[model samples]
Target: MISHFVNRKRELERLEREWKNVPSFVVVYGRRRIGKTRLLVEFSKNKNTFFHTFFEGTKESHIKALRKELAEFFSDEIFLSLNDYYTIFRYLADKIDAKTLIVLDEFTYALKGDKELASKLQRAWDHHLSKKPVMLVVSGSLIGMMRDEVLSYSSPLYGRRTAGFMLRPLGLFDSLELFENFEYGIRTYMLLGGIPSYLIVASKYRSIKELLKWEFLTPEGFFYDEPYILLSQELRELKLYFSILSAIAVGKTRISEIGNHIGVEARKLYPYLENLIRLGFVKREVPVIGKKNKGVYKLNDPMLLTWFSMIYPHKTEIETGVIDIENLRDELKKVMALRFEEVAKEFLVEINKRERLPFKFERIGRWWRKGEEIDLIALNEKERKALFVEVKWKDLNEREAKRILRDLELKAELVGLNGWEKFYGLVAKKVDDKKELSEEGFSVWDLADFKRFISLRGEV
Candidate 1:
């Protein structure tokens, strides 16, 4: 809708290249309304393709609709209508006699409605469509269904895809371009992440307070029912998960404390916490370099975090006016700024990927153990070496950087001999103009470094 501008250029290019290759099946996924459909369409505009959408309807009705759409692409094939769902595969085999692009959008819907869809697809593809000479794309919105129904190792269509794209929200740097100024841009982004719909509603040059009054605090607003809608789609036991999220957003992260605060036993909350982490809305952290089981969780989505931390709890305020709305709003903003440190670490993680440290890292998480903690930890498990990092949101004066360096030196010494080979990096959002960073003992990074990482072709 917005001219499909900026970011994901590499992904588009790769997709285009694959479309021209010998038979390739691609699975494209992301949260709903995230421009996944727009991207697929834009990339396939001039290509010979069959695109179809599945919606909430009976299986026979969907098959009839799909056959009708497929018939649009085939001029000579005597395909009046398609039945016996398996015949759709036969139809494809007949139609793609030459090279073609075939798109199945909202595939999760089909799989949801017809439990045998993946097996049906597998049969059709293997028996009739595999060598038909075409590029195939299966895209969906319901993340859990897409993974378990079609992509899991045990699924019928598993391993059929030549490549897959797990499309993520837009980057903050490119995302900020929608707003007029840095302040509104940041606040808007802080709340909305990079989801296209949420960003479309963000006001330019408005104070955070004005934005809430004008855009958010309303019945018809974009985010008014967002958390509920998102949660309802993704979670089954929604209330407990939401309660835990609200507790963390309100600053109760310790296992015992969050459990006590939310009236959930610590053990019962683990599944919800794990799910939140997998969804990228919440983070679990341990005290520096701790194991997976030994960490605390923090609210990772600032907007939703702020929403639950402030807005949700104040639902009655709209009717009763029992709370000081302005004070609550101000406190929410203050706490969010404090939480921006975690956001900064996420930015640094992206930079490390671009640098391509000597090791190939499958996962990069932060670490903390006892009195020692690194703001970011990039572990190249293949090489068994880790990059411990310090991230500062403030600009580092010469004195400040020196002090950080000294403290790092002490920590490194305490970490012992093997820690020398463990790379140490320092990152800041802003730093005084002093010198080029690589000259220093530690690898230094800032916003420029971050922008450079995403700029790399095929990097994201």
Candidate 2:
């Protein structure tokens, strides 16, 4: 079991603030295994709390389970016999004498089992629970259902919530705490993208190859079927979505290219792509300094990216136990390279947060026009200053580093920020003469900078 609670200070502070106010309704939600339950549990300590986890079952069974939990918490036999939501709320309102917390975790299962469950809870809250000194929290992992049934405008409980937020995965800095050092941390982050449970499993392994073999390559591996489960939870048309993800994973990024790869017309893919985007699976990216219509899709979820890129395409060979880890090393390196660019961007953003960079950039993203591409561009539109950065996944000596930076200066001209205060930089795994590059007014960083920044930030 993963016993350590890594970092959710902001979330805990938010919950604690709400705890001070009486009659607060809070909604917490996210993708499964993203630590929603654990956060709630951590927040619920040493209070008059009643926490119940609803499973997939009929409405009657759900009520029975809730009643049993409530009866145990309150040490009152009355709750055990109350079989309906409204009546139960009424009884709690009548019997309670002090402030209390009622947490409904996996509450979507109840909503799934009973279509009228939200309305019933709404009615209960309006008539009885809302006036009491109680804080009601409902959380679930079904993102679509949670939004529609709780957070959406059409939902009965929409305007009633005092606060609501979708808990996202940890950032690279925070996630580094789970690993031994920067190499293991960055490599694991490239594959898992800061999910706590997955990182816990990953922290147990010594090398990337061993981790992949034990947890991903075989049919019985923990993550072998994970993407399928996640997709099936929030989406229909699984086969089509899988195809789209796989297509994007292998570098078919344009809408037309993905359609061609999946044997579907480009126009017909918008809805599926939109749904994926809405659910946080895929993201559409356009050049930071280009036309709005020039968007290309990429898998936003890192686990899915790893799955489709490294596992899904080679499933047949993997299942037959004939696949060699060495054979996939090159492809894995490519995936890691792409992911490293994202990490580099994240590092720059963190640096910008503390004004460690030359100027505060308002926005940053990849920039490309035709065949030429810059790995990253940070823009301060108001100041008209721009930073062009090239990210590499390889080690470069002083001569090679200067060559890449000179080429970056050339590409900077094509960006059309001629009058803007343009700056050039590089980020890579290793750079031989960072001090020299820095002295030349270039922003250069390698893994050493990553470790230094992380160490200064806090424990890791």
Best by TM-score: 2
Best by lDDT: 2
Expressed as tens digits, the lDDT of each residue in 313-335 for candidate 1 is: 77777435455447575656555
**Per-candidate clash tally:** 7, 0
TM-score of each predicted structure versus truth:
0.79, 0.98
Model 1 CA deviation exceeding 4 Å by range? 1-3, 75-80, 203-205, 287-293, 319-325, 346-460
lDDT (Cα atoms) of all candidates against the true structure? 0.71, 0.90
Candidate 1, RMSD to the unseen true structure:
4.7
lDDT of 2 at 284: 96
Error of 2 at 400 (Å): 1.6
Instruction: Give candidate 2 misplaced runs (Cα > 4 Å).
Output: 1-3
In the range 191-236, model 2's lDDT, one tens digit per residue, is: 8898898898888887889889999998998899999888898998
